[model samples]
Target: MILDKEVQRKLKIEPIEGSYNSYAVQEREKKDWRGNIYLACVAAILAISFFT
Candidate 1:
């Protein structure tokens, strides 16, 4: 099946070789402590807002 130019342009194409590097980056992002803190703060704010 042939894909339209617009559809092809919008599609995200990644190389198989880059998949490993992308996985490593994702792993590093998962280990970010600052993200955890930010999430906790947001949760606390939401909880407080709901309660009060």
Candidate 2:
């Protein structure tokens, strides 16, 4: 699974063989940033809903 691949890559217990490692790194970082943005949007929506 890609999740396992990502976790293994970050933990560095075993190095990934090749291109898969770079792809995992990109995916992880992208998701991390996206999560921050998503949370901010959700919080804003909730706050606006509350105010209305």
Candidate 3:
């Protein structure tokens, strides 16, 4: 499920018809600032574990 942005851009890739638009994705995360903070905490833990 890896959408390689570099390859896609170079190849002029386009999404399928009737797909969920980018706006929908933005709206879904619009009110999820708290979730983002939690993710940042988890990422910090993982980074610390890796570096330490």
Candidate 4:
């Protein structure tokens, strides 16, 4: 599935609720980081497939 760049951009602009507490934010950030890494890896794999 293709991702819309604008949608991702808009999501980034919004403030997350319940993320102010240190522990909550830390856990949330870890999840977000993991998601970002996974998405990036998927994109990279797709790009590689197109070239090969």
Clashes of each: 0, 0, 0, 0
Q: Candidate 2: give the clashing pairs.
A: none
Q: Where is the poorest 10-residue window by lDDT in model 1?
A: 21-30
Model 3, 46: alpha-carbon shift in Å? 0.3
Give the per-residue lDDT of model 4 (tens digit) for 1-52: 6676543221224446777643322222223588889999999999999999
lDDT of 3: 0.63
Candidate 2 weakest ten by summed lDDT: 22-31
Write model 1 residue lDDT over 1-52, tens digit each, in one string: 7666543223344445645645222111225598889999999999999999
Q: What lDDT score goes with residue 31 in model 2?
A: 44
Global lDDT of each candidate: 0.63, 0.63, 0.63, 0.61
User: Which scores greater on lDDT, model 3 or model 4?
Assistant: 3
Question: How do the predictions measure up, each by TM-score?
Answer: 0.40, 0.40, 0.39, 0.40
lDDT (tens digit, per residue) of candidate 3 on 6-51: 4322233455568775222221223658889999999999999999
RMSD of each: 11.1, 10.2, 13.0, 12.3
Model 2 per-residue lDDT tens digits across residues 1-52: 5665544333324445774554323323324587889999999999999999
